[model samples]
Target: MKVNIYYGGRGLIEDPTLYVINKIQDVLKEIRVNVGRYNLYEQKNGISMLPNTFKEADAVILAVSMEWYGVGGLMQTFLDSCWLYADKQRIKDIYMFPVVVATANGERKAVEDLRGAWELLGGRVCEGICTYVSNRIEFETNQVYASIIEKKAEEIYRIVSHKAPMLPNSINSCHVEIPSAGIELTPQESEQLSVYVADDSFVKKQKEDVEMLSQMYKSILGKKSQPDSEDDLLKKLEKAFNPKEASFKAVFSINLNDVNKTIVLDIDDGKLKSSYSSSAKADITVNAGKDVMSKITTGKTTFQGAFMSGLITAKGRLDLMRMFDRVFVFEY
Candidate 1:
């Protein structure tokens, strides 16, 4: 069996919590158990990444000193990190024993807080050691207190060896609701990200990069989704007009099928006049989709080529129909 102790006290000379955990550790180790201890104050820089140590632990002793009111900041940070980075399945299998030593009042409340946190974390919680020791030296020197500590440690060993079950309570039923983040990670990736988060320099550099990217994106202007005007057909017609030297006279009704627009072109003596009209009489009526008209006007295809490809149909004289391309030739 393996048990790990997490000491969150500030290592003060007058801290009685340290003495209790040390005595407990000694009793547990006397039974030939693999034991380890992590002092949070010594490794404060990487506290966020400490949950990775839970992989091999069968049980954990969360020992904290209550100098003031609540559990210390170090222990709270460690618990927050476990909630963020620890594997939920692994946590469900590990047992937690809380030890809260109080110099002031509120020892019972702090113990309840510790157990509540462990229950919320989906871990099994065993009965813990909570006491008010105003005089550290007296608490440490009392033979009766030492015997009680040793017996509790042996009880911890028996609980683990027997694989005791945790009773289901409302606190255990309440699920942990983690806040949403930008990206999701697997267990391994979450551990790695926690390490990065624990490093001040890494987090600072990442924030700087993100700010730069945000400004870069804000400075760029993208094209609008909708066009500003709806006069593309007329504009193309006006731009593609090419006057002829010969004297020619013709009236052409060009109907754009898709757009439901008809363009009437009147050609007389090498001059051209255009108008949009629903009723127009012409020597030739050309019918085509707007795409075909755009292709012909843009010099991509000619009238004769389009007619042979069945892209356009005309209802008038073929001679005048062939003359349609001559007066309105487009340059590249």
Candidate 2:
């Protein structure tokens, strides 16, 4: 069934909360569910006024934050705009779920506001999940929240997977609320909260890198196996191309941008090996462990941002880097 998720928020002011929301999408995809996600921040009006892709979806989940007992300004505007469609029956039949990111102090208020908004739109209000991460939690601790969000996402998927053929008139049947806080944040204390907003510039760069690397890996992995006695450099080339029978090969190398690293990939087997050792020319040749390489190739890292920030570098044949796209096909 078609599934669409709408994420409306201001910015990445809190890393933990943002991490949780982002990871939830990954979890849904891992289970083979087709999901279309839209971030209100990137849109011109913060709401898709045109009939939303969510129209035909069996379920539509909205991820927004509560600042005090109210929805964030951006999210408020977005919801108000959505009334145009929801009121007209565009998304009237879709099951609606809300996920609110909030701090322990403001959790109740935030959730209440979200419920009010959901009901206002003639949408069913599912149980809401609240994720709390203290301001003191280091950004590195975000993984913890990611896991929590993933678990919450799993519960949501399960609910939608087995939803009653006809939802009851009541709106609370499908809500799953989670209120979390670090051990230090006592139940009584009021803590300021933040959500991690992905760097728009970085996310765009990362998407490009992931696409490039994914293509490279697919190409090399597609060819048949060759002899072990193949030239040493040729063997390395083949290994890079056909690592463990992967369909593509992504080679991380130094990039021209001081802030980013360049990824070179071999998408399909061609005669490129004929010029093996001329200079081994790639700026900052990277020899990543298989696991690390896989992550990079799969777009788990912000390659351009990493490179620009000095996380990656190049040494030779930088100009030939653009050849990657010509080598492999993008699967998605």
Candidate 3:
């Protein structure tokens, strides 16, 4: 498995975060993981193009130092570039592990922020290292600390190699649109602009070309690609129905998290009635993001598998919930 490490910390002699990431990288390499490391401080100029590196990565380590209150400007800028220029569909399939070492405070919050940002992009998250160090020499020299770091790295390697399933996160419920300066850039164009950003002649010419027209288009070209329509999803849900004789009657209220809509399935023996509304109370209330629901509809994931993985959540009669896939059978 290929694992990429993006170190957002400045290379300081006293930065324990640097030491931790090095240890993790070493452990990962010892296990024969194909590893790539990029120090963002050194490559600050090319960060806009860095997202393209996700192409070969099965998982990534987002290591940032909390020198003060947050994950620092470099990491934040890198994340912003990923949201604006990266192929988000590619990001969704990769796993992210966050490593934060704080000299002051807020290491846990920084990790949370990293996880939240990645999840907003629809990626999986693996557990990572978060710690505060008072003395860098003491922290790095300790054998126990080294052992723990080794184990975490090993665990991350195993997870990525296995292509593990993760519980769907809360970020699935909310996201902000990535605003564009002008046209939606292809990755190559985005990389070219990073070099052009410093050239006055190129900047002036590009701005002149986009000037008034940029405002006219606003975010028209940058708007997020939408998922399947509510009607289309509803039809798929209905079409997948496979009546079961054992259950006398059942009602399933499913919330499509991303679209902010709920669909109700009222099943009475062989008959089925499905519709959408803002509110729908039922015998079993299921909750999942649009992607998860699509998988269920397409028979890509079973209802039980979704529930067990926490991709699809159900409230009320969980026993009745287990019978859902049986009645509304989806096939490959």
Candidate 4:
């Protein structure tokens, strides 16, 4: 009788999604159901470990805010993490209820996406909540709205308690399987790995170890290790920097498939720091081919130009991308 609620909305004071979940939580508590809640915003660092929580949950509520057109990235990341690390056997039996609250448009589409995702993960999709509320106060104060939320909670309780039967879904019937992350880990181990993945210091240490090993192997083979062209580019970026503001920090993820490595650049107050690693939290993340990166570093192409030409892809804050060119005017 344990139900988990993962809130995938930004913690806004006036978010209607928060109001609805709170109401549902209260009703579930009154019915003596052991309810647990996880706010994805507060757990961004260890989202990859969250799928471990699914082991004990009989049912789960995937609640998210459709502020723009789709479910926020945090929820989508959580779902991706689950696909990568969760135990599919356990997921197949768990019931999933989607709670989508929209402040703009696309609530219905978001709901469908969530349900389809859950079903694809082999979870039972339950009829859940979906609505748009331009006026949070009005929606929260409406008695009918409150009643509907309470009824939904009651339905979950009865269905879970009685071991409700779920109709077959064609997607699940196809026996599609997602490959695991290739390693089995306990919950504690998964949490530790996730923490290490997000910790920049830990990743740096690992990179140092790898570099040391590479140098040793090169010496044993009687050959010199090739100079890291990308590393030189990073130093060049630092030398060319022109500071605009007093204090600012941003991380850029540059993928170089030629060297089979990803470079992370951390700029703090116009001071440049570079490493060969990954960061779960970055102001802006870019995925570019080696040619695109080479062109940008050589000043043959600009960040904006590469993006417009579909040579470089980026996500996160757009402002950071614009700021990069101003800070570092690359000259070949």
Candidate 5:
């Protein structure tokens, strides 16, 4: 039998989950079960591609270390990838056992979440391990804990080898029966889509392609393209300037539907300037789509207000961006 162990921990030296899995692996090895271990932290960049590893496994151990809260982000991401990419037919046959080692509370909750996620993906969830180990030294050295890990490994081997049968679960029943809005995509297609979605450049390129196609359609329909009004926007920006006591440089990345480009707003030396730039560096990166820009242009909303309302998304040096509305008073 071939079993895969996915360790969703930071690989800390003192992690109890790591210790438990190591012991379990030893027992599984002694039983002559082919075991493959994947440390999620080491494969963080290629996590979306990891689901392909499930092709050959008879069973999988979804191991996680709950330090303070629930299972960490790495584990959650792996499960999301599985849902998107793993072949549902293949997953339905494979068995999953969740092993959660908790440093704080919520070990039971994390295990339930892992089990539910696998079952919802049409996989069979087997009996698994859950424990709390506050003291690493005692937990690692305790023979009782070691024995428990070994026994659990044997139990998993028996279940997988025998193709154990389990009773129906209400959660799986509800999830399968309920209708959810989603496009039907093959595992390979879903994997490709997930990878593309995670890639900023690829998504931007797709948007540019779509915009180009839209413009072409408009031109074919005898609609004349609007003349560039970059100068008008710059003039309004200049007139709206209200210099503050403090001086700082800020760059704004603005996206407008009228133009298939990013407009940069550079503020320095009490002067406001606007230009089209793709590689411009900024202290604060702001994304104002066409609608948000309209609100700003009509003086119906402030930058801060737009951001708070989720109309605008900003990253990096946000405190500096907070001063944007103070320095630029838009005229209605």
Candidate 6:
């Protein structure tokens, strides 16, 4: 079946909403489903035309987010453009679904706004998945968020596979639940964690260095490569974190007491050669245990928001800590 995924909102390299859409596409491919994506941001200035090929699609999913309790302006423009297309062709049979990314706190309002938009467009709302990422915290690692998106996508697929019709009042729902246990540590445990003080002296410099390192990796890996295909890059990053890798040495002095208990990473070979450290003095560290961290490195999460919310943290050199920020690419 032909499927088109649409993205609407202020475009940002780090936004999780777009990340979820990309994840859905990955899941669909894994199941051998052919799907295409159209970035509303890219199409905003173009002649609004739904390709004849798209018109032939079995289904078209409208994936959007309600930003600030209202339809995001970019999304609004995209929806309006679709009306122009709908007028030119009869698209009444194409199945439509609304996927809304919202925080646990703002979900209700987000859903309400999305429903209003669909009604305005005379579009039927099929299954709706409300993904909740904690706005109060940084979701640096994909962990819970990735799982939620995959599960939601699978649910949507199941519904589509069965040829399920939109229920009169049914807005099927799914979400990621925040963990109940708060992260806590003892003084000694804290001491074992990595710490990088972002003092006023070098915080901005550190951010810039991290951005440059990220760009360097992107250049070597090619900007368009998918995260799943970058095992070599992941392996290189893994070796760099190993203390025995003499070609590289750890560049920071992490104070475990000041950061999250664990640091998971995937590094490149050149980067490993230049910065591997064995006695790296990390309380806990691992490589690619979760798919989401790869997404984070690829710029799926906002750097400032992720760090500020502790989604990403570091020990040792504040400068070295920022290197992880630039590694992953979000292919939504």
When sorted by lDDT, best at the front, the candidate numbers are 4, 3, 1, 5, 6, 2
Candidate 5 lDDT, 193-256, residue by residue in tens: 5443233454356457556644543443353333336656656667787878446667776665
Model 6 clashes, total count: 26
Q: What global local distance difference test value does model 3 have? A: 0.77
lDDT (CA) per prediction: 0.76, 0.49, 0.77, 0.77, 0.74, 0.50
CA shift of 166, model 3, Å: 0.8
Which of the two candidates, 3 or 4, achieves a greater lDDT against the reference? 4
User: Residue-pair clashes per candidate, as listed?
Assistant: 0, 36, 0, 0, 0, 26
Give the TM-score of each candidate.
0.55, 0.46, 0.55, 0.56, 0.54, 0.45
Q: Which digits, one per residue and each the tens of the lDDT, describe model 3 over residues 1-332?
A: 67899999888877888899888887666546789999999998888888878876778999999988888999999999887767776677689999999998888999999988898887888789999998888998898888788768757865665457787656765675766666687777556545422234543553564454344234333443445578877898788877768456888888888878898888886888888864445877788888767666766667765664446655555556567778877764
- lDDT, candidate 3, residue 23? 84
lDDT: worst 10-residue window of model 6:
253-262
Off by over 4 Å in 6: 51-54, 87-90, 103-105, 119-122, 135-142, 168-332
What stretches of model 4 exceed 4 Å from their correct place?
A: 180-332
- Per-residue lDDT for 20 in model 3? 91
In the predicted model 4, the residue pairs found to clash are none
Residues 1-332 of candidate 1 have per-residue lDDT tens digits of 77999999999977888899998887677555678999999999888778878777778999999988899899999998888777777788789999999988998998888898888889999998999997778889999898788768867876765456778888768776767775466686565655432334543564575566445334421312222122665676666767675578888888887767788888788777777785456887788887767666666567765654456766544456457677777753
Model 2: per-residue Cα lDDT over 165-238, one tens digit each: 34555543445342343334223221211111223564355457656755654554464343222233233333
Candidate 2, overall lDDT?
Answer: 0.49
